[model samples]
Target: TLAPSAAPAASASPAPSTTASPAPTQATDPAAAAAAPPASVVAQYTALTCAPSDVRRSAASTDKAQDWIAACDRDGTTKYLLMPASVVGTDVKTASAGLQGGGGTTSINTGQWVVNVEFTGSGQGKFTRLTEQTIGKQVAIVLDGVVQSAPQTNERIAGTAQISGSFNQSDAEDLSNVLRYGALPLAFERSQAESISPTLGRDSLHGGLLAGGIGLLLVIAYSFLYYRAMGIVVVASLVVSGGIIYASVVLLGSAIGFTLTLAGIAGLIVSIGVTADSFVVYFERIKDEVQAGRTVRVAADRAWPAARRTMLAADTVSFLAAAVLYVLSIGSVRGFAFTLGLSTLSDVLIMFIFTRPLVALLVRRRLFSVSRFSGLSPKMIGGRAAAVPVATTRARLAKRPTPAGQKRES
Candidate 1:
């Protein structure tokens, strides 16, 4: 009963087609999409090359907090500079990265790969404000005519930060050293850069890593030999410590631009001993307590308080030394200080939170102390088993040679 008029009407009606609709649905404004950053700004700088970590402030006794000035360059051209004055001191603290300049400044014979700078005291507040003000704005960090970092701040930065990009050892060190001496009066005369082969640097890095690896292995082996069963706890603590440190490094890199250098690796290597030293101290305390007639479990529990004190004392000193070094030094030295401090913190965490608890748990197992293979034996630890002395054994050791000639008649 299909009518001709009904068939035509059905054909004219809109159909869900295999393709998209003819008319555009909710058209987006081209300008709006372009208004905000489409992708992350940090990622953009990930491949940046020769970028300087120098953050400039205005000149001395100037009225404006930030000022723009034109200065002469070696190429006989003018370049703009944005230098901010120091808020607290006469001179703003910049990294001493070791640059080539005369006037009491020693030339760095070797190039530095990376330099890290942090804002301390009121500088922290100033840096936070600068990042906030520059949000969504292109802020160019330049050294001479070279653009170091030109990124748009996405959010308000409340803490210190690291400048990122591809930087050679010389460029970074030169920039850091320049910043340390305060902004150039006008412009820097560009000098011919002496090219250094990356191969040499790579070789040095390989050597440093090999040494660190060997040291770590030795420490682990020594712990096993001396501490016996408890060495397992020490190894576990070290593993946990390393994991935490790695996590911290990654997080810091993403969050604040912290970079690990060869010096930083050395700092980490040094921490292996520091971390193991804590275990040795704790285990020795426990053994002493065991020798005083205490059970393995009881000794572990009682010795912890004293062990905790010693660990805290030693680690505190280390942390303090690292802090002072960070404050007083610049460039890669600061990186070393930072890693050292971070490792100390990790050591404390492993010792109290993980190591102590793990030992306590292990000792609680009934078979742990009873098994001769466990090495928690009273004889092994020289404990008070009321051990009787052997006359034969004592006599041999106690008997001294009668004098050179008299002793010949053995």
Candidate 2:
């Protein structure tokens, strides 16, 4: 895999050509771009401007002795590199025949990022001869009419050669991938392209919204049926959470180009379950305290500490999964992950700032004491009926007749 730089350049190298004209340099370091204006005066690029060419032009040039062609450097600069335009040495029809592959790595000796390019058995001989002719001169590796790299030929290489320059990790990897896969990795034939009609797009949006609404209604119906009057808390919390999520989505769309697609609506529907689970956890905990003989008011407050921990744990896991998916995925999947994560966070806020306090307040009301209305009432939660106060029992004993004479002495 390691070949010393003694080989000559091939009459033509294995770099692939693009069908369209080459584009200007695409990648640049922000810091370098920022400092470029002041340094422009000292820097210079001398290659003459030349018209672009494709594989046909490159193959035609190979019959001639040499043709000077100018191509933009891949580096983040305005300079152009000049070289002989030919894909001659490699099989012209299949440009990759002479090349094996390439990759980016840190040189063990120099400790700098570099790209390693390997050649096929036949390409080795041709490359050796080309390098001999261009020794000490820069040989530009042309891909898509642009110069990927213009490495100075040092010596004759046998099978592999290293392209070394001032490169960051991303730059090195990009060059490596380009070499590994030809300029056009897959041959694509020309085809007609059309956009979906606006009416079709609108129908898709309506369908997604309708599905989400139906799911939400089912959850709300279940909450009302099971919790009765106490279900209002669940409904209120959801409303508040939905409001916050809506505002966030609108603000983010304006700020960061976030478009809510159908996949995102699916994510929102899934979040409904997550939010409902939080309510169920909290409500169940309160019922447990009520079943243990606590009043609705006492149970509401006492159950919170334990309920909060459970809710937090569940939301944390949910948020982490969403975050990981968002980071690892692309396209519409990312949209789903982002919405799920956002809703998870909103659930935490509603649980703490809204739901917990609301329950605490509501449990103190007379409405909550009514078994028929508040599903959290002791009898409703499968606990014993509410008993009279201990104070009232003591007063009744005091008021009893003095037949038991000892009671009057006090």
lDDT values for all models = 0.56, 0.62
Distance from true location, Cα of 304 in model 2, Å:
1.0
Best by the lDDT measure = 2
TM-score of 2: 0.54
Tens-digit per-residue lDDT, 1-410, candidate 1: 00000010111112111010000001112232223322332233232222122112211123222322221122222122322321212222455332223211346523323334444566556545555444443333333333232333456655434333344656656545543443444434568878899898788789888998899889878877876667788778888998999999999999999988889998998888889889888888887777776788998999999999999999999999999999999999998999999999999988878999999999988755655545565777654362534566344556665776564564
Scanning candidate 1 in windows of ten residues, the lowest lDDT window is 1-10
Best by TM-score: 2
Q: Which pairs, if any, clash in model 1?
A: 48-166, 56-84, 57-83, 57-84, 58-83, 58-84, 58-85
Backbone clash total for model 1 is 7
Model 2 lDDT per residue over 1-410, tens place: 01111112223433222111111212112232233322222231232222243333432332221323333443323234233332232311122111212333223345555666556566455555555554455555555544565566666555555666565667667766655554432345569988878899789889988998898899899998988888899889999999999999999999999999888988898999999999999889988887777788998888999989999999999999999999999999999999999999999999999998899888888888656668887777655565534653343444556675365565
TM-score of each: 0.48, 0.54
